[model samples]
Target: MSEQAQQTSNSYRSGPDERGHFGIYGGRYVAETLMPLILSVEKAYKDIEDDPSFWSEFYTLARDYIGRPSPLYLAQAMTKHLGGAKIYFKRDELNHTGAHKINNCLGQILLAKRMGKTRIIAETGAGQHGVATATVCALFDMPCTIFMGATDIERQKPNVFRMKLLGADIRAVTSGAGTLKDAMNEALRDWVSHVDDTFYIIGTAAGPHPYPAMVRDFQSVIGNEVREQITEREGRLPDTLIACIGGGSNAIGLFHPFLDDPGVAMIGVEAAGYGLDTGQHAASLSGGKPGVLHGNRTYLLQNEDGQITEAHSISAGLDYPGIGPEHSWLHDSGRVSYAAVTDDEALEAFQLCSKIEGIIPALEPSHALAHVMKIAPDLPADHVLVMNMCGRGDKDIFTVADKLGVTL
Candidate 1:
C-alpha cells in the first residue's frame, strides 16, 4: 500500500461495532419478522468482505462496466470565479447512469446475485437510484422493481421513463405527501413480503444493520479514488471535502476515506427547501432530533408525537426526513459539519456552475456547490476544496425549466 493509503487505513478506527452501532446512531431497528433475513444478509456480506475474488469481480466491473476512477478535475473557471480556494470536482457524474448511484448499485447487485436472489427492489427519490438499479438488473437479467414517490415520479419523469425503458417495474408510492420516506416504507413492506426471492437494494447510506455499512463500503470507492487522485495531483490531502446529503450515501462515500484526517474539514450540505424556520426543509441534522426511521436510529425530522414529517427540496435527491446513521453519529461526534442550503441558493449555484464550469450539476450536488460558493470565497487561495459531483443535470432540466417559468 502507498503511504497515504496506509495512513488512511490506520486512521479510520471509528467504524461501527459488530452489531452495526455507530456510537448508538446505527443499529437494527427493524421488524422482528425481518431480523433473521437481515442477519443472513449480514453474514453473506461478511463472507464477501473477506473474499478477494468477490472484490476482483467487483473491481473488474467497476472499471470495465461502471467506469471507476472518475476524473478529479480542477474547475479552473469555478476557481477563478470564486477567487479564493482552488476548487476541484470528483466527477462521478460522468459514470454510467450519470451519477454516483451506480457505484453502490453495482456492488449491491453483485451481492444480490451471490445471495441467489432473482428479483431486486429499490427505492429512489430523484430517480437516480431507481434508474441505476434498473440498469444493473438489466445487466444481470434479474427482475427489478423500483419504488418512488408520486411527487418524484412527476418531477423526475425522464428517469421514471428510463427505468421503464430498462425493463423495470416502476411503482409509484402515494403515502405521506408521496415522497422519498414514503417510497422507502413501501419498499420495505415489499421486501418483507417477498423475502424469499427479492433483495432490497437500498440507495443511500441508511437503513437497518448491514445496509448502511454495506452501502458505505461499496460507495467508499469514491473517497478511495479521491484520496489517491488528489494526493497525486496536489501532493497533499484536500483541506475541505463537500457533498450534498439526503440519505448521505454520496457524502459518506466521499467523507469515509478522510474521516481519520483531522486536518481535512468534512462538510455535508442538506436541503433547506424554503429555509429551516419555515419547517418545510430537509435539514435533518440542523433541525432534527434523534429518532428511529426506516429500520435505523438516526437524526430525523419528526414531530412531538414522533411522526416522521414530510421533507421538501427542489432537488428530489436531497428530500429526506432523516440522514444516514453514520452521518448522525459523525455530526454528534464533531467529526463532520452539517450545513443547509436553500432551494434558491442551490439553483443559483446550479446555473453558476453551468455558466462558469460548463458542468450542469444535478440539484443534489448543486446543494454542495451552494455551500462551496458560500465558503470558498473566504478561504485562502492555496486551500483545496474537493466536492463530489454526484449526478448530472439532464434528468433535472424539466424541473429546472418549470421552476424558472420557462416553457419546455
Candidate 2:
C-alpha cells in the first residue's frame, strides 16, 4: 500500500510515535520516578523487537510451550443457525493456560530475563493473565507475584487456584470497587517501589508506551497465524473480523495483521453491563471520553469530575474502565467499529455457543459472540466473519453457575 493509501485508508500500520503517542491516545505519562524504568523497558523491548535470536526464542516457546498456530475452525453449527454469515472461530482458547494471555506473558518473561530481572509482577482482572504470568514465572524460575481485585479473586476462584498452583503469591487488591483497576493500581505501586528487581507484566494492551505496543506485538501472533490459516482455507481474507475488547489484547492481536487489508472490516465488542444508558456498563469507547489512566491517554469511563468510575460486566475480564491506547486510536480513526453487548446477551450467547459448537467460551468472547449472533443472520450467506474465542470457559463455570442458580 502506498503511503497516501495507507494514510487515507486508515490502515494505521505505523503508530505510537517516538514519544509513544498513538495519535494522542498513547504516551508515557508517568512520574519522574518511573520514567527511567519505563524508558529502560522501552529500550530493552526495542532492542529485541528486531533481533532475530529474540524472535527465534519467542517463536520456539510459543510453538513448543504455549502451543502456537491456534486453529481457525469454521463454526458450521453456528453458521447454519445464524443462516447468514459463515462464522469461523480463531481458537486461541485451546492454547496453554486456556487463554491468549500466555502469548504475551512468554514474550515479556523473555524480555525480563534478558533484562536480568529476578522477580515478576502482574495485575489481572479475570485471573487469566495472572495465571499466564504465574505459569511463565514458574517456567523461568522467577519469583512471581500477582495483584488481583478482591471481587475478581472471589468470582474467578478457579483462576486464583491455578495461579497459586503455579507458585505465585496472590495479593488481593481491595481498593476502589476491588476490581481490575484497583489491582492495576496496586501493581503499579509495587513496581514503582521495587524497580530494581521487579518486572511488571501488564495483562492488557493498555499501559505506558512500550507496554501497549509491546503486548499488541506479542499478541499479534494470533493475527499472523489467522492470516495464513484463513488464506489456506478460504483463499482470501474474511469480510469482517470480530473480537471482544477488554484491554483489547486479543482483539488487537487478531486485528493488527489485517489492519492494512482495507477489504477486511474489524469490529470490537465491549461489555455494556446493563446498557449504555444505565451508567453501569464498561463500554469505554461507546460511553467514555478520552483521559489519562494507567500512564496512557485513552478513552476512560470517568465522571464529570474526572474520577474513574467502576465498570460493570458479567465477565470480570471485560470490567475495565479504560482501553489500550491503540484501541482508542483505532476507534477514533474509524479503522475499527466498536459495539456494546449487555450481560444478559453475553450469557445467552455463552449458552448458545456451548450448545451449538460444544465450546464453552469464557464470558469475554461471548460478548463478541453476542454481536456475531445479532449481525450474522442479517448478512449474506456467503459473507465470512471471524471471531476470537480467546479463552475457555472452564475458569468461568462457577460464576456462570451462580448466575444461573445452579449448584456446581
* Best candidate according to TM-score: 2
> Tens digits of per-residue lDDT for model 2 on 295-324?
999999999999999999999999999999
Pairs in clash, predicted candidate 1? none
Q: TM-score of every model?
A: 0.97, 0.97
Report the alpha-carbon TM-score of model 2 versus the true structure.
0.97
Task: List ranges where model 2 is wrong by over 4 Å.
Answer: 1-11
lDDT of 1 by residue, 1-408 (tens): 223222123444456778888777889998887898899899999999989999999999999998888999999999999899999999999999999999999999999989999999999999999999999999999999999999899999999999999999999999888899999999999999998988999999999999999999999999999999999999999999999999999999999988888889999999999999999999999989999989899999999999989989999999999999999878877778999999999999999999988899999999999999999999999999999999999998998898899999
Q: CA lDDT of 163 in candidate 2?
A: 91
**Taking the candidates one at a time, how many backbone clashes does each contain?**
0, 0
Cα displacement (Å) at residue 302, model 1: 0.5
lDDT of 1 at 375: 98
